[model samples]
Target: MISYCVFDAYGTLFDVHSAASKFQRILGNKQESVSALWRQKQLEYTWLRSLMGRYVSFDQVTADALQYSLQVHGFQEDSSKVNLLEAYKKLDCYEDVQSCLNQLRANNVATAILSNGTLPSLKTLVENANVAHLFDQLISVSEVEVYKPHPSAYDLVTRKAQIPKEKVAFISSNCWDAIGAANFGFQVFWLNRNENVPDVLPGKFTTIYNLNQLLDKVVQPS
Candidate 1:
C-alpha cells in the first residue's frame, strides 16, 4: 500500500504554460513557441549540469532558459524577460490539482511535492495557487544540488518522508522524471496530461490521463 504521494511540481502539479499565457498580450503569436522552448532548455540545462558534475540551482537554470528562449525567438530581452520570470514565480495550478490532493488527504495518504524548483519559488507558487495546505512537504532538488532524472534527486523523497521508495507513489507529468523515480524504485505514476508518446526509458510506470485517476490506480492501505 502507498503511504506517501510524491508529486513533481512543474508541468505536473503546476501549469508551466501559465507563465507564458500570462503574457500573451506581449508575446503576440510567438507565445506558445517561446514557452515550449523555454521549458525544453530548462530541462536540458538540468541534465547537462548533472552529467557535467557542475551543479547549479534551478533558479539559475530558469533564468538561463528564459534568456535562451528570448534570444532564439528574436524577442527583446529588456523588460519582457523580467516580466516573464515574475509570471513564472506564481504559475497557475492545474484544474484537477485541488480535488486530487483533497482525495489523497481524505484517505490519510501523505502528499509532498518533488520539484526542480527552488524553495522560494515553490513556496510562492503553491501559496499563490492557494494549495499550500495540501502538501505535507515541498521538496526541491536544491536539497541534493542536482535536478531530476538523477538518482540523488529522487532520493530526496526517501530522505524527507523517511519511507521506503516502494511505499511512495511518485507522480510526474514529465516522462523523464517519471522514469527517474521508477528507476529509483518508487511506484511511479506518470500524469500524461498531454497525451504524448511515452519515452523508451527502462523503468516500469503507470500512465494516467489526469490526477483524479491516481487514487484508483494506486491502492491505499486497508
Candidate 2:
C-alpha cells in the first residue's frame, strides 16, 4: 500500500498561470505567452542552477524568470512585475485539489508537498488557499540545496517521512518531475491536466487526467 501521497506544488495543486491571469487586462493578448515563457524559464533555471552547483531559493528563480519573460514581451513596467510577484504568493489552488486531498485524508493516507517552492512560499500558498490543514508536511527542495529532477531532492521525501520509496505515491503535473520521482523508485503518477504529450524521458510513470483518478490508482481496495 502507498502510505504517503507526495505532491508537486506548482501546476499540480496550484495554478501557476493564475498570477498572469490576474493581470490579463494589462497583459491583453500576451497573457498566455508570458505565463508559458515564465514557467518554462523557471524550470530551466532550476535545472541549470542544480547542474552548475549554484543553488538559489525558488523565489529568486521565479522573479528572474518573470523578469526575463516580461522583457522578452517588451513589457518594461516595474509595477507589472511587482504586482505579478505579489500575486504569486497567493496562487489559486486547482478545483480538484481540495476534494482529492480530503479523500486522501479520509482514506488514512499521509500527504505532503515536495516542490521547488521555498518553505515560506509553500506555507503562504496553502494557507491562502485554506488547504493548509490537509497536508502533513510541506517540503522544499531548499533542504537539499537543489531542485527537482535531482536524485537528492527526491531523497528528501524518504528521509523526512521515514517511508520507503516504494511505499510512496509521487504525483506531479510536470512530466519532468514525474519522471524524476519515478526514476528514484516511487510509484509515480503524472497529473496531465493539459492533455499534453509526454516528455521523452527515461523514467516510467502512470498518467492520469486529474487528481480524482489518483485515489483509484493508489488507494487500496478495502
Candidate 3:
C-alpha cells in the first residue's frame, strides 16, 4: 500500500512545451523543434552539471536551454527568449492534474511534487495553475544542489515524508526519472503520455497512458 504519492512537476503535472507553444506566432513551423531541442538540452545540462559537481538553479538551466534553442533556430531577437522564459514561469498544468490530485487528496493520500525545479519556480507554477493548495509539499532537487536520477535527489522524499520507500508511489513522465525512483525503492509509475518505448533500465515501473489510469493504478491494488 502506498502512503505517499510523489510526482515529477515539469512534464508530469505541467506542460513544459507550453512555453514554446505560447510563441507560435513567432516560431510558426519551428515551434515543435524548438521546444524539443530546448527540453533535450535542458535535461543534458542538468546531468552534465550534476556530474561535474557544478550546480545551478533550474531557472538558469532553463534559460540556457532556451537560449541555445533560439540560437540554433536563428531566432536572433532577445525578446523572443524573454517571452519564452516568462511564459515558462507559469506553465499550464496538464488537463488531468487537478482532478487526479483532488482524487488523491480526497482519498487521504499524502501528495508532493519532487522535481529538478527550484522552489520559487515550482511554487509559481502550481500557484499560477491554481492548484497550489492540492499538494502537501513542493519539493525541489535544488535543496540538495543536484538534479534527479541521483540517489540524493530521491532521498529528499524519504527525509521529508518519513515514509518507507516501498510505501511511496513515485510518478514521472520521464522514463529515466521513473527508473531512478524505482531503483531507489519506490513503487514507480511512468506516465507514458507520448507512447514512447520504455528504456532498457533495470528498475521496474508500471506505464500508464494518462492520469486517469495512473489514479486507478495508484489508488487500487495491482
Candidate 4:
C-alpha cells in the first residue's frame, strides 16, 4: 500500500463544477456551455502560456479563459462573471470526501492536495472543507512556476513528506493528471467520479470510482 496520497484540488477534491453551478443561478441554463468552455479554456491557457514562458497565476488564467469562452460562446460582456467564478475557491468538498479522508487518517496514510491554484485558493478550500488538519501538507504548483504534469510540482510532495514516488498514491479526477503522474513513475489513481473518458496513456496506476472503495483495496487485506 502507498504511504502517501496526493490529490488535485479543484476538479479532484473540491467540486470545481461549483463555478458553473453558481452561474446557473445567475444566467440559468445559458451559463452551462459558457462555464464549461471557460474551464476548458482556462486549462488550455495555463498550459500554453506556460510553454511560451509567459507565467501567469491560475486566477489570471481563469479570467483569460472566461473572456475567451464568453466571446466564443456569444455571451454578453460581464466582468462580474469572472469574479463569480473566482468565488468557487470558497466552495466545499464533495459529501463523501470528509469521511473518506478520515478513513485515510485512520490508516495513517498521508493525504494532501496538489493544485495549479494559488496558495490562497488552496487555503480557502482546506478551510471550507474543514479538513485542513487532515492533510499532511498543502502545496501550490506555483512553487515551481509551473503546474502539474511538470513533475516538479509533484516532486514538491517529496520535499515535505520525504518519501519515494512509488510510495505516493496520486489521486486525480483529471485524466491529464493520471497521465502526467503515471509518466512521472508515481503510483497513480484516477478518482473517476465524473465518468469522463479515461486517460489512454500508461503508467503505474489504479482506477476507482469512489473513495470508499479504498477500504477493500487499500485499507483492508484481501
Model 4 TM-score (2 dp) = 0.92
What are the Cα lDDT values of the candidates?
Answer: 0.91, 0.95, 0.92, 0.78
lDDT tens digits by residue: candidate 2, 1-222? 898999999999999999999999989999999999999999999999999999999999999999999999999859999999999999999999999999999999999999999999999999999999999999999999999999999999999999899999999999999999999999999999999999998998999999999999988788
Per-model tally of clashing residue pairs: 0, 0, 0, 0
TM-score of 2: 0.98
Better of 2 and 3 by TM-score: 2
Model 3, span 34-71: residue lDDT tens = 99999999999999999999999999999999899999
Of 2 and 4, which scores higher on TM-score? 2
lDDT of predicted model 4: 0.78
Clashing residue pairs found in predicted model 3 = none
lDDT (tens digit, per residue) of candidate 1 on 1-222: 888999999999898989999888989999999999999999999999999989888988988999999999998888999999999998989999999999898998999999999999999999999999999999998988987888998898898778988899999999988999999999998999989999987999999999989988765545
Q: Give residue 96's lDDT in candidate 1 (0 to 100).
A: 98
- In terms of lDDT, the poorest run of 10 residues in model 4 is 213-222
How does residue 33 of candidate 4 score in lDDT? 79
Top-lDDT candidate index: 2
